[model samples]
Target: MTTTTATAEATTATDVLIVGAGPTGLTLACTLARAGAAVRIIDKSPEPHRASRGKGLNQRSRELFDDLGAGAEAAAWGTERVTLRKYRDGVAIADTVAFGDRTPTPDTPYASGLLIPQWRTEEVLRRTLARYGVEPEFGRELTGFTQGADGVVATLADGRRIKAAYLVGCDGGRSPVRKALDVTFEGRTDTEECMVIGDVRVDGLDPAYWHQWFDEDAAVMLCPFRGSTHWQLQGMPERDADGRALPPSLESFQRLVDRCSRRTDIRLSDPTWFSVYRINVRMADRFRTGRVLLAGDAAHVHSIAGGLGMNTGIQDAFNLGWKLAYVVRGLASPGLLDTYEEERLPVAAWTLGLTEERLRAVTEGVKQAGVGTEAVVTDDVTTLGVGYSWSSLAWGGAKAGERAPDGPCGDGRLFDVFAGPHFTLLGFGRGSAQALAEAGEKCADRLRTCLVDDPTGHARRAYGIGEGEDALVLVRPDNHIALSAGADRGAEIADRLLRLGR
Candidate 1:
């Protein structure tokens, strides 16, 4: 795909202007660029973040990265299925395997989450974005913005101006774009609960396990990052006399480790990053206002118990990228963009509730039996079960609005056909030839049709189609099933695509 960036004197024009070049913004930029949309991504930070913030990726996020062409590099730099080792009073207690007894299947290839530092994940995304001839403009910050009927005009901190058909905030929780829109972030912050988190180099510890030490009053976890010497530390913070958490430092972290493990032999030094983490569960009332929109942390933030923060944001970008591209290219009506919020907002709500429950369970389990951090790991956190069944675009079958399952397709797999920025029409069995031909006739430019050869019956079983039956399944660019129907409904499928474009 070919893309172009426009600039006129002091003002820059783009199809989408993304603020905050973190994983969310970078992912969005990459997605749009791949779809031939002119995009510009800017961040206030002078450079990429060095700290390991969100330290893992769920299975769904792994799939998104795979689709973006960064999966191989990420897997090379990441460690999967690290064992969780628990300790009590400096003595070993229990050892639990991550994603116990789960392995990759035909329909779901990514069976386990990956342990890679947040910085590494961002690095992978940045590299992918660079492949599209786009690089993030660091130190460029959005000061304010105003939207008109056609586009948004954004002012920067440096007095530069940007005009874009759409502006998305992939910014952090304290997003200026969302605030300028005056959207309410409805949730509570837990001031009483806090944890000190950072990346540090530690000696006298095995790099094999995610080490966790638990006691009655406090707990600490040190997870060794893959392909690095640094370990991400999370522990109960020391409080002052007024019951306020003190500032985090190297010495404070050492004390925390010693007190939590009841061991003085473990040595810690060279702290690269440190901060106090508070429980803040908040979601923006509206993900979009006029031409401005929000994704990632700007849209919703919840507990990090399930490591859903970064993954959710990456998925949000994937969901919005194709819709934005379609509208900008005039191939789809502007109303198509409304479905982004419609589909993602409910997922955000579900994520908040699920993570909150997990956090509460971990807290109570720690008090009862000194449960390890592995207690938080469940199949739900993998995010493979998450779907948009309630979405307006979902229709005709049980699989609609759900993720398109991967399966055998002749020499390769189903994902190989869904790898690009185009919709896929899967015609199951010979009877679907008419439906495939009709859909191809109407949406040939934006759609790819495949007559699935299911000799092993894996594809049929995964998609809920009978062995000898035929069906037509339309999959969105983001790999979500849009609609499913019998093979005879060829014209109906074509009509749906035409209506969407209109």
Candidate 2:
């Protein structure tokens, strides 16, 4: 790893400076770079992390990835609907399918979850980011920085200085940016509980199912990864008699398997990465401070029980990316950036509560036959139901701040039209032509107008517009409804956008 920073001048610059190259930072960097913005991403680690901690991609995150052009790559490398087989005291007690298959509807294109290692997810995102000619700089650590009214000047550990209009901390839980800003990360850590998670190869373990062995006190699980020899292992440790925690190692893991599964014949080998993670449930009091902000684990951390940690961070990056792009491009108001925190903070809090509830539900009850783990893996956890209905940007329509659904358009899906770095105005029927024309004239550079004149009424029903009742729905670049109204509110729509920039 090269530690020497470029010494061109004291005022090195970019449009956005991102600290950390994990899933969150990579997604934000990709989004900004794809929008023709200059972005620089740096990570302290010498190379990419190879842990398989987070393995599930929910429906909403999948759609976001699909929009970002990384979803297909992810789907190509991921597995679908692996069943969970539960055991107790060496006997196969129950069989449950945690991720069942589901068909896509006109409104929802991705109805099923995909399981892949988090490191692989980052690989696909990094590949997409490379298409924009932006690669993450490793071995560059953020030592300190200062932000002002105009821009931010960040100092790296290698004695480099970077000047950028915006600085984001996608760094993990111990975020330097958040700490420097003194933003309160409110939460508690379960010192009594720790899980040994790792990726390893095991003999005598079937690759077809997610093997789980659980009892009243301890559990060990091995989940198979697609197209790979490694399986993700999760095991609760048996504390010593003095109440001291045991260190994580292959030997300890073998003991866990022996004690929980009674499988002395199974041999574990090629242990790649492992950690005894102390469960932390935390969220920053706020997500922004001036031009510097936080996304992903920098802003929030949750228990891994529901697999929402990485997915929520990805969603955070998606929500913040376009808003930051618009403001940086001078197409929108600075206050537009404020909506990132406003819209996502509630969702983060709700996720914390939901995950805590699900964690308790799944761990406290009897290890029953056919006990549904569906609550943790269903559409709710997929974040398909997440919306910004209460945000200030939402007005006039019943589904404002909600996700703009996909429908049949021309020869492709409606999402195909909403694929790039531009907002879309969907006008239903001939009555909306005037509104579309006026809005198009006002925001011609950043907005695209699409008129759906289908006789089958699929598009109308997709957005819940009644027959012959014209409506106008404006979708943001992140595929959320920004404004919705009748055909006559063209002036109001234009005025709202202008006010948002103010």
What tens digits encode model 1's per-residue C-alpha lDDT throughout 420-479? 899999999898997798789888878899999889999989998887988888889999
Query: All candidates' lDDT scores?
Result: 0.88, 0.85
CA error at residue 151 for candidate 1, angstroms? 0.5
The candidate that achieves the highest TM-score relative to the unseen native structure: 1
Off by over 4 Å in 1: 1-12
Q: Write down the worst ten-residue block by lDDT for model 2.
A: 1-10
Compared with the true structure, what per-residue lDDT tens digits does model 2 show for residues 176-259? Answer: 889988899999999987888888898898888888887767788888888888888988865788977787788888888888
lDDT of 2: 0.85
The TM-score of candidate 1 is 0.96
TM-score of each: 0.96, 0.95
TM-score for candidate 2, please give it.
0.95
